[model samples]
Target: MKYIVVKLGGSTLEQLPPTFYKNIVELHQSKEWSPIIVHGGGPLISSLLKSLQIETQFINGLRVTDQNVLDIVEMVLSGSVNKQIVRHLISAKGNAFGISGVDGGLLNSQPVEGAKELGFVGEVVDVNTDMIKEIIQKGYIPVISPIGIDENGQRYNINGDIAASAIASALGANLCLISDIPGIYIEKDNIKHTLKNITKAEVEAMIEDGQIFGGMIPKVKAAIDGLVHDVPEVSIINGLEVDSLIAYCNGEEIGTKIVLNKESSYVK
Candidate 1:
């Protein structure tokens, strides 16, 4: 069966309607394509940190996670946010299994390139697809939180988008990032135009030129990273659009498709 990894960003998850969960349930029951959900909880984490009088910092788009912050991250992402998504799926009449990367060694990770500056932040080195496959074989949608663990019993905060991309690449599945907007947009004169297709080089250039900033940097960077790891393609789609997931699966043009090569067809 074909697989699709759907990533829900924290900013957009609360605004998504019930229909979004219903569409996910439909996909689970359809047998045409199996869906795996990976989600983030940045806003919730930040809120909790604030309430606890903890200071949080971000370099680029990634959160700098020390041990204290990592604990809160785990408590929020794996504990509350993960269950919330599962509950929504269940309410939509779907069987959902929620897990974090730390569970069952699902995501074996290592410190990222800049470990000194970004404490406890990791990049996935390997994924345990066997557990994920078994979860899929049992006819349940797997909802994943991006908290990763290393060999030394150390936990790391994995970027949700990067985690989804890693899982998609490992499963040989397509990655779809759910965003508040339809796709990446650039302002020309007075009108903002959505990019139908983009390449890794173009994405980097856009970032360098300040066309893409803030949280978008990580999404596009994650897409490019997934492409580098052999994920067939990654699409950024708006979850607020009714049946947007279905539209993407139906081959309807609805979002930006990011590719590694310029020669690829972006129509689909």
Candidate 2:
């Protein structure tokens, strides 16, 4: 079966716009392809930490996951956010199951000891695909949380983008990242949207030239990694659009498609 792995950003999750859910359901009923969802819960985790009076920090866009922050990350990402997405999918008639990187040793990781002060954040070293395959074989969409396990059986927090990219790469699936904006904009404030197909090198040059900066930097980097790792195509689409995901999956041009090399134009 043709497979696509989609990473829904935390901001998108918080919005939970009706149109987004409807499109997902519509695609779920299509039976043309299988989708595996990997989601992030950064905003929720931050809110929860504030409620608990825990200070939050970030180093190079990744949360500085000390033990306490790691606890909150697991709670929000694995417990609350994971279940919320699973419930939404099931309610929409999409067969969905919630899972984490730690379940069944799905993602084995090593501590990112580059900065010892960062505590329990991890980098994925291995991915066990058996459990994911089992769920796919059973006809259930696997909705994954980003928490991972370390060599010493310790749980560690992981960057959601990194986690999602790793899962897509391991599965050799087409990857899509759903965000609030319409892909990577050449100018964030400008109303004009450039939806042209682009290459990894072109994106890098844009970044170097300052056309792409700020929040888009990491996302484009993630897309580049996915393309380089053998996933044929990666896209960044507007999550708020009613049928953006379905349109992209059906080969209808609705988002910015990132590719490794320039090729003949073909949609659908």
Candidate 3:
């Protein structure tokens, strides 16, 4: 069966319509493609951190997660965010099991290069593919929270995009980044046009030219990183559109597909 790893940003999850969840359930029930979800809860985490009067910081888009912040992060991600996604799936008549990277050591991680600055932030060292596969085999969609744990029992905050990329790589699945916008766009003569396809090199060039900026940088970077690690395909699509996820799986060309090489890209 074909597998697709869907990365749902916390910023967009709450705004996503019930039909989005229904489409996910439909995709899961289909004989062709199976859906696995990896989700983020940054907005909720930030709101909680703010309410608690805890100072938070970020460097290079990675949160500087101290012990206290890590506790809150885990609670929001593993507890609330993960279960919320599962509930959505269940409400749509889908069987979904929610788990964190810490569960069964699903994600083995180590401190990132700048861990001293970004405390408790980790990069995925390994993924428990067997455990994930077992969950899928049991007829349940795996809703994963991006929290990694090391051998020493220390949990780390992992970026949702990074975690999804790693999982997609491990499973050799297509990675779909669910975004609020239709796709990456470029401005020309005061008009913004969504790209049908983009290459890694082109993405880098766009970034260098300042055409792609802000939060989009991390998303494209994660897609490029996934391609480098052998994920067959990665696309950024708007979750708000009805059947967007299903359309993507059916190769309907609704979003910007990212590939490693120019030759691998379609001439759209």
Candidate 4:
């Protein structure tokens, strides 16, 4: 089965139009692709923590996740955010089922090396595809939360971008990173334009030159990683668009697609 692994950013998860979910149904009806979603919930988690009077902070764009923070992160990502995506799909006449990395050993991870200061945040060591495969085989889109587990059954928070990339690598699937932004942009002669295509080397240079910084640094890195690891394709697209998802699946040029080399890049 051809799989399209989508990573939905939390910034616009709740606000995605019904058309986006309708495109998901189109993928199912097309009989050529299976959609699996991996989602993040940063804004909602922060909102809930603030309302609950729990203090939290990020170190270099990575959330500091102590036990208190991990509890809230999981609750938001696995509960509210995951359900909202699944419900939205179903409401649009699509079938979706939500799961977390903690469920059925979907993601086994260990604490990120040299970043112990970040607390329970971990790097995904492996992705178990059995559960996700079964869900897709049954015709339900699997919505995943980036909450990982260790062999000892300890839960760790995984960066959604990294988790999505790792899962794509494990499955050798196409990855579409859905976010609030349409695509990466460059300024020339004071005109800013979104780049429809870019090469991995160009993106690396952009990151090194600090042209790419903050959270986008990680997403770009994840996209590049997916490409390097043999994922057929990877794109960072605007999730808020009415047809971005379908356009990507249909091979239309609409979002920022990352490529292994300039041979596949058509940056105009």
Best by TM-score: 1
Alpha carbon deviation, residue 208, candidate 4 (Å)? 2.2
Q: Which one wins by TM-score: 2 or 3? A: 3
Score residue 240 of candidate 3 by CA lDDT: 95
For model 2 the TM-score comes to 0.89
Cα lDDT tens digits, model 3, 1-268, are: 8999999998999999999999988988986888889999888999999999999887756778999999999999999999999999999999999999999999999998888899999889999999988999999999999999999999999999999999999999999999999998877678788888888988988889888876677778889999999999999999999889988887898889998776533222
Task: Highest lDDT: give the candidate number.
Answer: 1
Candidate 3: worst-modelled 10 consecutive residues by lDDT: 259-268
- Write the residue-wise lDDT of candidate 2 on 1-268 in tens digits: 6778889999888776767766666665667777888898888998999999999987656678887888889989999999999888877777888999999888898887554877888877777878888997887888999899976789988777777777788889888889887775554455555655777778878778877775467677777887777777888888888778878887888778888778523221
Could you report the Cα RMSD, in angstroms, for every candidate shown?
2.2, 3.4, 1.9, 1.8
**Higher-scoring candidate on lDDT, 1 or 4:** 1
| Residue 177 lDDT, candidate 2, scale 0-100 | 89
Give the C-alpha miss distance for residue 188 in model 1, angstroms. 0.9
- Whole-model Cα lDDT per candidate? 0.92, 0.80, 0.90, 0.87
Clashing residue pairs in all predictions, respectively, total 0, 0, 0, 0
Q: Against the true structure, what is each candidate's TM-score?
A: 0.97, 0.89, 0.96, 0.94
Candidate 2 — what's its lDDT?
0.80
Ranking by TM-score: 1, 3, 4, 2
Pairs of residues clashing in candidate 4: none
Give the better candidate number (1 or 3) by TM-score. Answer: 1
lDDT of 2 at 127: 78
